[model samples]
Target chain A: MKAKPKQSRYLTLVLILGLIAACTPPAEKTAEPTSIVEADPLPSWNDGPRKEAIISFVEDVTDSASPNFIPVADRIATFDNDGTLWSEQPIYFQFFFALDRVKALAAEHPEWKNKQPYKAVLENDMPTLMQQGEHGLLEIVMSTHAGNTTDEFDSLVRSWIDTAQHPVKKRRYTELVFQPMLELLDFLRANDFKTFIVSGGGIEFMRPWVEGVYGIPKDQVVGSSIQTEYDYNNGKPIIKRLAKIDLIDDKEGKPIGINRYIGRKPVFAAGNSDGDLQMLRWTDANPLMSFQLYIHHTDSLREWAYDRDSHIGKFDIGLDEAIEKGWTVIDMQTDWKIIYPFEKNQ
Target chain B: MKAKPKQSRYLTLVLILGLIAACTPPAEKTAEPTSIVEADPLPSWNDGPRKEAIISFVEDVTDSASPNFIPVADRIATFDNDGTLWSEQPIYFQFFFALDRVKALAAEHPEWKNKQPYKAVLENDMPTLMQQGEHGLLEIVMSTHAGNTTDEFDSLVRSWIDTAQHPVKKRRYTELVFQPMLELLDFLRANDFKTFIVSGGGIEFMRPWVEGVYGIPKDQVVGSSIQTEYDYNNGKPIIKRLAKIDLIDDKEGKPIGINRYIGRKPVFAAGNSDGDLQMLRWTDANPLMSFQLYIHHTDSLREWAYDRDSHIGKFDIGLDEAIEKGWTVIDMQTDWKIIYPFEKNQ
Candidate 1:
């Protein structure tokens, strides 16, 4: 087999190529309905009062004959993006994007080398960045996100998402999304529910990848964003981005955002943190077959679990409220069949 | 013929009952789809670049096999709640709710009897109320919206919507929603598109009835809101509303609100007036299949037709930009199969 050095090297290359080709996932197939009733992802969910309550609500409301049957135009459901539909462990996904943006845009703005958050970001100094806190995060986001028009900003976001990878997980940021939650989104949409991602992240940050990752179109995603200014330059008009925080979209802001943006009260609401408490409360208060669910991160093996004290994606107050209010608290370790699509038990 | 008096009275009673029964819709069929479909609601739409573009985009994005195939989770589609989804011809729906709220709450707070906007609202003096401008509207909203938790405020709104009637339309505000737009929302949801209502209306004012009107749930609604305080009163913590304008969900505010609330850019957006232009602009900036539709009120018979100068839902700058930008401009009169779902149309 080792006839010559050159011959052996060529043989090794061929074998490596063959293995790589075999390991690659087959081209994605056309998703088709295999059966009308195939499988239930959350089979452990008991057919008790809570579960039946949802089913009966949907049935009675969706039924045209029932006085309670709501029109199809009104079957809206809203879910918080971070922690609710996707995992927000260690840090938020958007913050990672911000850090990457800071690094990418740093070379152009060498002044950022001395800046607080950017300096911290470029040096991979998490502790320093944390010290800078929300104001620092805002500065970093504004510096990296501003100066460009909305169009240019969107491109930057899209490019970064396409190339960025989570440092710890060594996976694309999109791959970090929870699989069971993804299935839940699909299930809701399949049942005529209009699902929305109401998050406190930058609006433009999620718009680029949400369609590809969450199946939610850009318009359906509501998030926090910076202020913008429209002006004329060289006889041409253009909109320029400004670093100022236009609105803060968290906590009580959720209900306000929902009211202004969606102009409706959701029949169903889901979140993983206290930031979404008001949204859940507002939804539950409605005189409809409404439901609210909270995601509890309790598993450390599959993912980090630090609920009582976490700088980002805190879940302490909301978790207690969920329990006290008899809300459906999804036990990440016990309930979820799979946490993420990319990971398999080692 | 001599027995005509008794016979006439009996016959009149039967006729009156028949008319009343006719006014009400046939008991909605329990098994029927929640809203109308297959009506080809927008028949005047040419099978040209504009119409086909949207249809093809939706079809391709929903195919699952296509490269543009969006996941069900990311199928969020945002809409402008005013003219785009319903009639904002002579007045905004919130204005109507405000007027009624002012009158209902007037006798209790007689000081409003001498107030500017409140007095105007109480006396049905819309002209004076309009003059109070956005400031007046905010005042009215705050006065009616304050002194209660979000839950209590929502109940008040619900009760008002359930009973209030539009002066000219003489129908519940819920019935004022455009039939075609309602179908569009349903169609999108059926195809896994999550629909939302983004508006300049007060958040608390709209959430109570939006689900009933637009099929958009409370949490899916985003709108302008005031600052609130959550406190424990009488051993029960309650979220009290305030008069301070925390945020305005219109124009530039739209994009920021979109960011803060939905966390993703919408693939599709439909709006009328300059308030929605930035939202449309933001949505169009997405890399994937995207669309921005403008509702041009061109039908005076079924609905009012005035662009560029209408005070209520003005469409001057937006109309020009839409045409130049190649956005879908729906000529409401010509394109619609029916303006509203009423006895005559149905």
Candidate 2:
């Protein structure tokens, strides 16, 4: 019964209203954001401020019409392996591997039974080993990590990762990976972000299992590395792992490692320690809409929750900075629905 | 009139013959290969043994039924950037960049006018610079390349590449990229191979424009790099390039660099000099079907031609090895339809 002109004008008004609603800020809208239309990409992340911030930021950067839109090629994300992605409670996983290696090789080197750090490692004397400090740790690392071809070292690392269990958790080290972080990685990758593992752990040690556990390929991993020399062994090319230190992907080294390996500023960076402060600072200071996420270990019952004063992953400085900068601070206990992937089944 | 059973049997026989024909090898077949269905991927590559071998190898490795089939993730192809992807005549493009930098900075440092390599560069005396050798070259490189933030260096390189002209050709340095090689890169990428530039040039220098010139991303470029330090300058994060030699991606260093950067052996490797011998050897020795291609600079009319005795990109050992191993030797004069992409419009 409506006139043709009246109907046309009504239709135009509806269309204009829809366009305005689409362009409205997410905070002003009642409807779910477009990013939330797909099945929850971060199912493990509980519906919280952290999750919402992450999703909104991703949507803003990926949406072409948005002023904050970042090109897919420039969507680089760097992640910290220990503490951030997985548990680093009893000590770094690589340190445990090195300690185990020292014990395994003790029979061959009878002299190690008498040496200071080696003897401490052989006897499982944590106090004595800790007393030796960085010097002792380096000694232990060099002795067990060097004198082998890269292939041999890789094989060794692979075998150890396959079998080694975390001391207190009694779980395979890879099993301790944070499910929420894993979901976060997948979410970022689905949005055309290239994810990299920027770790302080030995690069070779992580390369063997990172692809299998984290979906990050070997080349995408930037970590502390020992010097390797190319030599012909029995007329076959071999890269011998040397005792010398190359680059350490920690503290200020994180930015340097990102520059050296990725050759691009990361749009997103996640870490859980003071060592990650510079990396967070770098990522936050990116000349774009960058996201700096820090995972705070607040889940004491679900996972070991030591920070600020923890020896392994000290978080005091970074935590303060995160608050000051308004970066996403993931309170693990409240933010994550599940801690480890295994917890979902339980 | 034929009986019904006889007619059915005749139809089955025809279908069997068609299937057999489809499965026949290219050499034995009358029809075009499936890969050729889409357009000539390498139009600049003149139809020859070299081009045929490359196509055949790529098909074999990518074929699912073939025993030598490599999964897409493992299908890495590394190309030397300087002489393999681009022309390196008279001297390396990088050496030219370094010399120009020296001359530009000579005004600020009057002392450089008296220095060995700097003085040679200032005076444009190639003989004197050559006599000073690698030591003098390093001195010049360190003086000009270091002391700047990576961003500043990148900007400088970007500006220079955009404006600087090739001495003899008077073309932009990027215009000197080999057309055939560019086509080859695209062809390999289309066939699911991840292409990387494993060059001996400074990584920082090449990172600025390689993506635009060669379509190879910065992270995929493995090259010589200087040490860089992360520092807080004026309350901002900055990575300062240092004068120290980090990794030299040449000769034996090529294989080491590939392993360090790509973290996997390349299935296909291409180069034009002895410096790439180790890289080719590494690729050829992969535990899968591999292709080693050496570009022989036999084209004097279209591009400068030099081989065994040339100081820059010397092709002595690699050329001999290519012959011994039955590797694909690209006789640039005969095999390439065009030398540079710019020549196509002409």
Candidate 3:
């Protein structure tokens, strides 16, 4: 049948529209998608004031027209490693590494069987170790952590992490990372923030596995370090770890470490203990729109809950400051849908 | 006035070819372009073996099908800043900063009028300052460099650099940067290499201006630093720079600094003095295909030419090693057509 000129023109218009639609991405078709299919950058974070605050802050800072908008280069976020990003309940995970290292090296150092801290570590005498305090910890750390090239130390750490399991959880140490924190990291990175791990743990120990575990590169992880010397053995340059401490990145040292390593004030800082108080305060002091978050350990069922009186990761000063300063205090017990990644299947 | 079916089909083929050609970028049209419009990534470099070697190495490493192909994450390049990147004549540029700072602060201390190093700096007596040696240098450095908060120090440095001029050439210190080296940095970055400045100068002193001058961000600069303490002065967190040295970042300290800061050995390294020998050797020791380059000061007319005899940036050990190890030695007189970027217009 012959078609009229108006009908033919209408048919051409429909064909052109179809072609244009075909070239466009499927996700661009709708202005908004239903909640079920919508992208959740922070999927593990439940709907709460804390989560909303974070979202709103990120959106405001990244919006070009917003007064709070910060350039992408200035979007620095720092995370405290121990209790903030992972479990540090019974003790710091690094202490376990030190203890295990003492046991592993005790065979070669027969005198360690008679030494105070080494003997205590070998016999699992926590009381004696505690009595010795910082001195005892230093002895154990110096013995196990030094006197090897960086490459040798890195290999040792890599192997130890591969086999080490948490005593209570019976899971690989790397698997204990907080799932919600991981989501937060991704969300911040997606919004053009450069995330760094500012930790009190050994820098070398964390550098070996940080990229694999947290997706933070080795250079981006700043932490405590022992003195090292550059030497040539067999005509090849090597950096030998010395027993003396270079920088203790704990307590007040956190802010110093961030300034030394990053050379810029972070806009966002998250921490869990008093060790991170100075870091939080530093970030809060920024004139720009800043976010200071503290992960409060209130989940006794899902995770160990302790603060103020805890031997490890004591959270007294920082908790008081967060409350007084109106910083976001994440009630882990209520806010998190899942604690560790392994909890997803269960 | 009628076309044959075969002729009509040929016309349709030509139209299809034209549409495909229109969609492709202009650069893709030709496999290569001759000198006039060719992409010379290192335009400051003259046509010679040194330039060819660099281009060939970059091409080999970036080619996915080649055995020498390096992943972007593994493509690390470290450059020594003082003599290699910029002029170190009339003493290292940082010493001038220290001297100026001493004069600026001299009025505060009446005792400084008699103090050996401070007195020499105030009098502009170079001979006495040299006589004081390392001990005298440390005294001058500590008096001028420490005791201020990191932010305060940054502002002071920024202000000083904005107004300071070279003692001899009278150019801004930043303007003395080598043009060829700047081009090399861009070339390396274009090939996906993460470039870092590993200097023996003060980290804080360099951080304020490096981003603007070198295109290398503050976080990527590794250098000597004094100890810093995090303290609260009236409820505000501040990092106070202390008098004591934390790291030297010279000679054997270069490798130690690299290990502590970068945590990964660079696949490429460039330097111009004995201080950088260990760094280059450490880079060469990497298991990957690597490149080591040294810039030899051979241009006396355009720039000050001093090497082994010069107290500043002495190149004795490194010059010998470069020849013996078959590393690229860039003869500044012959290899460079222009020295500094400011010379381009002239």
Best by lDDT: 3
DockQ of 1: 0.12
- Measured against the true two-chain complex, the DockQ scores of the candidates, in the order shown, are 0.12, 0.25, 0.30
Worst 10 residues of 2 chain B by lDDT: B1-10
Backbone clash pairs in model 1 (N, Cα, C under 3 Å; residues 3+ apart or in different chains), count: 61
* DockQ value of candidate 3: 0.30
TM-score of chain B of each: 0.82, 0.87, 0.88
Interface RMSD of structure candidate 2 (Å):
15.6
For candidate 3, write residues A287-328 as lDDT tens digits. Answer: 889999999998776777778845453578889989999999
On a 0 to 100 scale, what is the lDDT of residue A124 in model 3?
A: 73
Q: Give the Cα error of residue A32 in candidate 1, in Å.
A: 28
Model 1 ranges with Cα > 4 A deviation: A1-40, A43-90, A115-117, A124-137, A183-203, A214-224, A228-241, A246-302, A305-307, A310-339, A344-346, B1-93, B115-138, B145-149, B165-240, B246-346
lDDT of 2 by residue, A1-346 (tens): 0012221111122122112222212111121122333588897777878999999999999999999999987899999888899987656777678878998998999998899878877876655665665566667778889989888998999999999997667789999999889889999999999999998777888888898889998889998777778775555778888877777778888898899888988999999888788888888778989999998988767786666865443579889989998999999878887778776665
Q: Residue B330 error for model 2, in Å? A: 1.0
Per-residue accuracy of model 1 over A217-253 as CA lDDT, tens digit each:
6667777656666443443434567866554557766
Candidate 3 local lDDT, B29-63, one digit each (tens): 11112222268887767789998999999999999
Q: Comparing 1 and 3 by TM-score, which wins?
A: 3
Q: What is the TM-score of each candidate against the true structure?
A: 0.66, 0.88, 0.87
